[model samples]
Target: MTLHTLNLTPHGLGERVMPLAPTLTLRNGQRWVAQHYLRYQHTVESVSALLAQIDFDAHTPLFAGQDEQGVYVQVGLIGRENYDRSNTLRVHKLVYGRKWRIDADTPTSEIIQTAFLAIKKAREHEVRELLTVRSRDGKTSAAFSNHHDLPLLAQQRDQLQAGNHRVATLDVAAAVQHQLASLRFAQRAIELVQVLELSAGRVLIDVQLGAAPLARQLEGDFPEFEQLALCVLLPAARLHELPYALMDALIEHSDRHVDETFRFRGFARFSRSNQIQAIADLSLQTRPYAHDLADVQFEQIFRANNYEVDASRAPALGEGELGRKNRQLINQYENLLGHLPRGYEQTHETKMA
Candidate 1:
C-alpha cells in the first residue's frame, strides 16, 4: 500500500518521502512532486491515485481557473530542501533570499535592551533560535556619549584606550574565565599577565592600619568586614613582595633605560616624525618638560653650543640628594633655553621648516 505523502517541505524518512506528497496545485498554479516519486517508474495514473489519496480532487480547477487534471507537475515536489540535497547535477543553483535594511541614529543602550527583550520573548514562545540582527554605524570616531555605550565583551573590547594617557579597563575576571572554559592555556596565561599588569600600580601603596584602625575595628563588629578582609584585603597583602621585585629589576638594570623610558621615547618619536605633530604640540601645552632631555638645562646649553664642557661629566648625586640636584638641573635647562644662541634658533627653525 503506497501512501500519499504531503511534503510541504522535503522531509525524508531513510531516503524516502514522509507525510507523502501533496499532488494538489498551489494557489500560485504550481504543481510540486515528491523527490522519491521521480526516482522510481511513475505514471500519470499513479500520480492521480496519489493525489486522490491525499484528498486532492483530480477533476477540480486549481489557481485562477486552471484545470487540475491538465496542470503541469514538476518532478521534484519534495520542495526546496530535498531539491537542494538531490539536484547537484543541475546547472542553475538555488539563490537564497536575504532581508537587508538601513536604520539611523539608534541609541546603543536601547539596541542592547531591545535585543535582550526580544530574545527573552522568543524563548518564552519556545523558539530555540530567533535569528535577530542589529546594525549601526561602524565609524571609528563615533563619540561615545556614555561609557556604557562601549561594550565590555571579552572579544570586542581592547584592554586599553587614550591617546597620551593610556587606560586599561578590561574585565580581567571575565577574560580569564572565558579562556579557562575554552581550554586556551596560552591565552589564559596572557590574561593572567594582563591582570597582574592592571593591578601593578597599587602594589606600592603601604596599606598600614590607621591609628584608630576602623577597618580592623569593624572586623569584629561585622561578619561582612571579616569576609572582605579574608577575600579582598588579605590576598592583597602579597603585593608587598612586588616592590622588592621592582627594586631588584631596577638594580639589575641600573645602567639600562627602563621600560617606561623606552615608551616615552616611542611617544616622542611618534609625535616628532609622524603626521601626528598635533599630539606633540598639545603636550607642549601640558608637560613641555617631557620634550626636554633628562638633564633638562644642560640639554639646552648643549643645543646652544655654549659652555664647552661635557654635560655628562657633572658630579654624581649623594644619597637622598637627587631631588635638589634634579631641581638645579631643571633650572639650568630653563635658563639655557631662555638665552639660546642665534645659530641654535636658526637650526631649530630649519628643523621645524
Candidate 2:
C-alpha cells in the first residue's frame, strides 16, 4: 500500500518525535497474510508450523500486552521470560487464550514496519555480497605476481568462498606483504635514527651524501609503503604531538631549523628495511622548513624546547641570532656536501663561512 503519512506516539519524547500520518507501509502479501489470522483462527496452525519447522524456541514471549492495532505480539518463551532484542518478525507461533486481551487489529504499524525492515536488511546483505566480490577481484591483480595468468588468478580469487582454500592463500599473502613492507620501513627508520646519532661533525655530510646516493641506488624512487601495523611511520619532524609521549619528546625540539636540517643529517643515514617503506609518507609528514639553507651550518646541540601555554605568539628569531643558536645546523649541511672529498673544503667554506 502507498504511504500516506505516519501516526507516531511520542513514546514519552517531547514534541521532537511525534507520529506522522503514514510512517510505515506493507508488502503485497502482508495484507493477505494478516487476513488469514485476523481472529487468530490460524494462530494455532501458524505457531505449530513455526515451532516444528523454524527455530523460535530461542526467543522469549510476552503473554499480556497485546495492543489494539495488533502490531506486535509479546510472548514468553521457555528460556527467557523478560523482554529482549528479538525481532518481532521472527516470531512464528503466538498462542493467546480466548479471554486474553490481545490487540484486535491484525495489521498494525508495528508489524508493517518490522516486515519492511526485514526486506531492507535482506537487500542490503545481497548488495554487500556483490560489492565484496567486486572488491576482491579488483584487488587480486595488484596483489598477485603479474607473471601468473591474470584471468586464472582473477577467476580463482573471485570464486573463493568463506572457507575455500584459495581464500586462505589470498588473505595470507595480503597480510604478509603488508607486514613485510612495515618491517622494511621500520628498518629504514632505525637507520635514520643512526643517522641522527652520528656526530654533528659528520651528520650533515652523511645526510647530504646519503640522500643522493641512496636515491640513485633506489633509482630515484621511494618504495611503495603499506601500513601493516597499528602505528604509522612519520618523519622525525612529524613525530611531534604523536600520541606516544616518547615521540612527542623526540620531536618537541624540532623547529623550523630542525625540519630543514634533519634531511642532511638524520634522513641521509636512513637505511632501507623491510619493515617501513611508504614513499608518500614523508611527503605528508612534517619536514625541514624551506629556507635559504643552501649555505647553512649544522648545530652540535639542539635548541632547548620552546613551549608556552599562554604565549600569544611565537618568539621571533632574527637571522644572525638564529645562526648563533643553531651553529651546528650549517655545519651538518655543509658537511653533507664535503662528503664528496673533492673540492669539499671550497664548497664547505662558501656555504658555512
Candidate 3:
C-alpha cells in the first residue's frame, strides 16, 4: 500500500487510506474475528500535535459528518476477511481512538481544524475506511459509504447444491427453537455463522444458543410470510457420519421413517412438505432435531469428541481462541444492543453526485 503525504492545504484532492503490515497484540478486551488485530491508539493530544504541524484554513471543512458532535474520517484498510473490505469506520479493530465530539459552544474554526488533524492522525495509524458524513437529514457529502456489494446469494437461488446433500429451506425460527441442549456448550467450535445466509445451501445459524436475529426474523416472517423458507444445508459426508440412532430420529421427524416411532406425538402439525411449520406448531417438540444436526456439523468440522464438545468439561477446548474472541463480541453486542440483533448496517449508495 502506498503511503501518501497528508494534503494539509485548504483544497487538495482527497487522499485514500491504505494499510500497513498488521501485527497482533495479546491485550484483552480486543475484538477478533478470523484473526487477531493490531490495536492502534491515537489519543486526542497526539492528533492535535499532528495537526499543528500541518497548514490549513481554520474554516476549511476537513472532515465530513452531519452531526455537530464530531466529523467522520475514513481511512483505508488491508486484510483478508470480507469484513476488511467495507465500513472501516464502524469496525473497532480497524479504527480505535477517542471520538472527538464537538460541543455546542465550540468554534467552527476549531471544529474544522480539529477534524483535519483527526484525519491526519487516523491516517498515521493506518485507517483505510471511507467516511461519508451525513447531516440530520441523513445525506452524505460523498459518492459512496464504502459498503460491500450485495452477495450473490441474495440474487441467485440454490447455488451450492452438492451431489450428496439435498438443500431445504428451513425457516429461521424452526431452526432456532431446537432443544440442542446437548450441543449448547459445544457450540463454540463451529465457524461463526451468518444468520439466514445460504452458504452452500444452508442457512447458517446457532441452534443451540439462542439467536437475537431469530427473534427478529420470527417477528418479520410470521406476520409476513407465515412460512419463510430458510435453508438447512447438510453435506453428504455429515449425513454419512450421523449415528444410526440420530439418523433414525431425523427420518422419523421428517416422516420419511416407517418405524413405530412415527406414531409419536411429535410434529403432528403441518403437511409433510413443511417440516419447519410442523416443528413450529409442535412448539419446538422437534428440538432434538437441532441437537442431532449441530452435533454432526460441529464434530465433523472441529474434530471434537463428545467430551471435548462439552463446555463444562472443557470450557475453552473446542472454542479455541477464535470462539473466545467471537464470544466477547457477542457479549458486546448484547450489551450495546438488545439480545436480538436488528441486523447489520448496509452501506448506503448515494444518488447525488
* Superposed model 3: Cα runs more than 4 Å off: 1-66, 75-148, 155-157, 160-353
Clashing pairs in 1: 4-20, 5-19, 5-20, 5-21, 6-19, 6-20, 6-21, 33-77, 297-332, 297-333
Error of 1 at 70 (Å): 99
**Could you tell me the C-alpha RMSD of candidate 1 in Å?**
35.2
C-alpha positional error of residue 146 in candidate 2 after TM-score superposition, expressed in Å: 31
lDDT of 3 by residue, 1-353 (tens): 22123322111222111122122221333321111111112333333434344332221123233244433332222222222323222222323333565432233234444544454443322211221223346443221223334475456546734345332344443333331222211111111233454465443332222331333333221121122122234432233222222222322332321121111124212235556664565443323334433555533433332222232222231245665454545444433432222222222122343
| Over 4 Å off, model 1 | 1-279, 282-304, 307-353
Give per-residue CA lDDT, model 1, range 1-353, as digits (tens). Answer: 23334333232211222222224333345554423222222233333323232211121111111133332222111111211212133233222111111011122222222322322222222111111111244212111111234456445556543233222334333433342232211011111222333254331221111121343232221111121110111123233233233223222232122111212112422122445566555433433233333455535543443232223224343334664454444444433533332233322322121
Query: How many clashes (backbone N, Cα, C below 3 Å) per candidate?
Result: 10, 47, 16
Tens digits of lDDT, candidate 2, 309-348:
1121223332455534444354466335312332223433
Instruction: Compare candidates 1 and 2 on lDDT and give the better one.
Output: 1
My TM-score estimates for the predictions, one after another, are 0.12, 0.14, 0.14
Best by lDDT: 3
How many clashes show up in model 2? 47
Backbone clash tally (model 1): 10
Better of 1 and 3 by TM-score: 3
